[model samples]
Target: MLKRYKKYSFLFQELVHRDFTKKYKRTALGIGWSVLSPLLQLLVMKIMLTKFFATGIEHYTTFLFAGNIVFNYYNESTSSGMTALAENSAIISKVNVPKYMFVFSKNISSLISFLLTVVVFFVLAALDGIEFTWKITMLIFPIVCLVLFNIGLGLVLSACYTFFRDLQYLYSIFTFLLMYMSAVFYDISAYSDFAQKLFLLNPIYLFIRYFRKIVMEQTIPTIWFHLLMILDVCIVMIGGFYMYKKYNHDFLYYF
Candidate 1:
């Protein structure tokens, strides 16, 4: 894959550039919107949920940031990625290129947006009185795993979407429900042990929990926690890649 990426580096870069062009072109704030958008969402969510849910969590705002950032990245990446092949149907039908290139570029754009706000998250954490640790460095592990996880899942979704346009509507609803399932503001300690384990079944929740454990709790997650996150990535990536290989040709028909 690295060799393929190197072979097609120029096209990949252009796809990324085009994504930025389409998203920020003629906008006043330009890239500044990347930072501001998530903060605005954080503001809205905090306003709505803090009173009811912030009761016991220390540094509730920071906790909210942790969930909002991770979930939004997943949302944006997969949403754009769902249309990767279809959006570039012109280019794909006319030229021979790796379809995954479009999806990768889309994910990269979403990742850039997420990283900008990560800077704000750190600054906010400092002001909110959360102590930092070297474990903060390990936060990148979950971020990296999440990028791969998104790509894998993006592959599956884009494949499915080519054949079923209604998937787009269904996905919006799923993500809406996913926001709450991710425990963006709620503390899940109130749940029974079995229910607690069920929350870990959600890969997004696992990543959010990782951030919370590091940023708010100032601790590293156990080995099992890391493995579980990786396991989720592996399963999803394998499934996505397989789905694409099987259906790549069929995508042309639906497009």
Candidate 2:
């Protein structure tokens, strides 16, 4: 498995480049559009929410940036991952490469886009006068954990999608709900105790909230937060790998 992962690792970078290039090849603006989408969303949300959210939390724009960056990548990967195997049917059938490669490639593509947007967010945060600290260095750990979590998620979801076409529809609806539940636009503390506990149980929420604490508040999350995230990553990656190993051969038949 390690050899297989390394063998096609080069393809990961190439696939990511292909996806990024094709997205803006003919456009006058080119890659600027990738920077534009998230920036525009941030502007619209800032305007629209000012009237309602009003006073703002401590470093609220930074808070939203943290949540938006991570959540957007998760949304893109899992949603596209639903068809990761099925969409690559012709290549998978003709080649002997690992089935997980197709799914992993889609995620690497999204990760490239996400990194581009992160630059925009960093610049905007500086312009908005949000403070940057050495604490910003802490972002590295959470990001690595988030990537591992997403890879596991994409692998498992891609596998299930092979067996259940309905998973495509289900994944769409779930992403919509997951976005709101992630507390992207509001503080989780606004919810009742039971609701907050439920949110804490959600590993995605944990990841987003941890980022928010580091970037927005310039502080680490509580000890339990790190503990929970570590546990969640372990379970998801292990379970996802097992499922992928067991049924990956079936993916070709579905495609």
Candidate 3:
């Protein structure tokens, strides 16, 4: 994979630049939306749900920001990635380039937005009185995990999307359900032990939990937790790569 990217590094750079810049092409704030959009969401969620979910919860705004930012990045990357092939069908059909390149480029763009929001997240955390400690650096684990996971899922979604356009709409609904289940604006600590275990089954929720543990609880999760996170990435990565290999040729026909 590194070799492929190296061979096509020029195209990769162009794709990354185009993907990132095209998003805010005509907007006044341009790249500022990357931070403002998520911050606005955090304000609305905090104002609307604070009475119900924020009660007795410390640093509620930061907690909500953590979940919101993670899920937004997941949704944005995968959703844009799903159409990476179809949207660039003209270039994809004629240009001798990699299909995964589109996926990687789209995701890298969304990741740029996510990182911008994370800068604001830290500021909000400080204002909310959350103490920063050495463990906070550990969030690099889940951020990296989600990046790989999004790419893997992007590969699978883009492959499917070439054949079935309806997948785009269906995936939006799936992400909506995923957002609610991710406990973005609510507290899942109120659930039973068994129920809490069930939340771990959700890959999106797992990352959110990791954020809360590090930023809110000021502790690192166990090694088993790390293993489980990697397990989720592995399952998706293996499955996505398998589909791409199997459908590599078929993708051309769909175009």
Q: What lDDT tens digits, residue by residue, belong to model 1 across residues 164-241?
A: 999999999999999999998899999999999999999999999999999988889999999999999999899999
Q: What residue runs in model 1 are displaced by over 4 Å at the alpha carbon?
A: none
lDDT, residue 230, model 2: 87
Which residue pairs collide in model 3, if any?
none
- All candidates' TM-scores? 0.98, 0.91, 0.98
The list of candidate 3 runs beyond 4 A from truth reads none
Question: Lowest summed lDDT over 10 consecutive residues: which window, candidate 2?
Answer: 50-59
Distance (Å) between predicted and true CA of 145, model 2? 1.2
| Per-model CA lDDT versus the true structure | 0.93, 0.79, 0.92
Candidate 3 residue 91 Cα shift, in angstroms, is 1.0
lDDT of 3 by residue, 49-162 (tens): 998888878888888999999999999999999999999889988987888899999999999999989989999999999889999899999999999999999999999999
Residue 49 CA displacement from its true place in model 2, Å: 2.2
Between candidates 1 and 2, which one is better according to TM-score? Answer: 1
